[model samples]
Target: MEDGKLTVRAVERALDILLCFTDSSDLSLTEIASRVSLHKSTVHRLLASLEGKGFVIRDASSDKYRLGFRIWELSANMTHSDDPALILLPEMERLRDQLDETISLYVSDGLERVRVQAVQSNQAIRRVAPIGARMPLHVGASSKILVAFAEPEVQQSLLASPAWPAGLDKASFRQQLAEAKSLGFATSVEEREPGAAAVAVPILNRAHRLVAALAVSGPSNRLTLEKMMEHAPVLMEAARRMGKMIK
Candidate 1:
């Protein structure tokens, strides 16, 4: 092969090794070599290069390789420019029109969640969450949904901080998050703002990682607990559709 083609082949082989770990957390050298259809020595060289770059790590006890923290670091940087609001705006509009309630998209930002986009309700009385508004992750439905589906490390860090919402201890907050994850959605009534209620569902990427939260909010009188539950399916369906559109 030409020099350029040889370089491309090498890159492809390296990527093939990385992809092998997707279905399983850890793999032995022989397993990787077989999966990639490469010689054991070639696989060893590629694995060493990947380990040096912090893309994979070997377990000293088991002699198996697994993804390294650098993969998450790269994913974090990707999120910086990933604005799911652009993809979710149309779905938000559809939800707003269907329910005549305010629809908002929120993404995790440290211990807080930021409202990236919103479609307002035409009703005379409705909850209005301004775009760019930041709220505590432990409070509103949208914020809590973002927190509930956050990476385990991120979730633990946020829960340990003083940013935990008032009136709920760490244990209680953890239970709530567990419940949210179990139900595949979250609800809030006067948690963030008096007389405001909301229900939110997580928008996940193809990897099943949280990308954003889709929520509908309105006055407590209009969005009572029962009403919110009734509308939960709509919000979840919209979230599912949004997830497919986002990267």
Candidate 2:
């Protein structure tokens, strides 16, 4: 292989390894190898390289790999430049107050959705999601909205996975996505979290491509399925307004 091509291949593989951290907080060498579709030795070699650069490190307590401080630093800096989280913060707060539920903003990362910003619900008994929570693309309302509006390949890859991840089943997830597409919105009722339900709508950019998802989540007892359906239009409107403000 040519030198430049070889370098690109290595870079891609390294990035693949880093991507494994999206859904996993810690994983062993064998687990990382399986997730990344690489041999154990290859994973070890790449991990050594990353560890040297302070991007990844093995947990001394559990011997599992976790992203390192250096990686967090880089991600923080990149977030500042992209400014997606910051741009959406004001709107998220508004949505949270209007619905009195957790409001979250998520962006696609490969086949997963990463929570970039989250506002906690004010109600005493409410659903709470942290800022860095990672969710499967097909599970919750927010994630599905993000996936439904994404490139076809991105949605197809998640459907084609041989084994579905936690909080989602393959066949049911496909059916849900189809419905979400038809409705031009997404919803989940007691699917992702127990006693929790949500409605989500896709945010699009000037190019009419998916940029993010805006979601409102609360306890199912309070945010009934009927009420969620009622609020679907509200979520869509917020998504549209946020999309316009994004770029």
Best-fitting candidate, measured by TM-score?
A: 2
RMSD of 2: 5.3
**Candidate 1's residue-wise lDDT over 122-166, tens digit each?**
999878777767788777788778888888987888878875656
Worst lDDT run of 10 residues, candidate 1, spans 75-84
Give the Å error, residue 51, model 2. 14
Per-model TM values vs. the true structure: 0.66, 0.68
Please, what's the RMSD in Å of model 1? 16.7
The C-alpha RMSD of each candidate to the native structure, in angstroms, is 16.7, 5.3
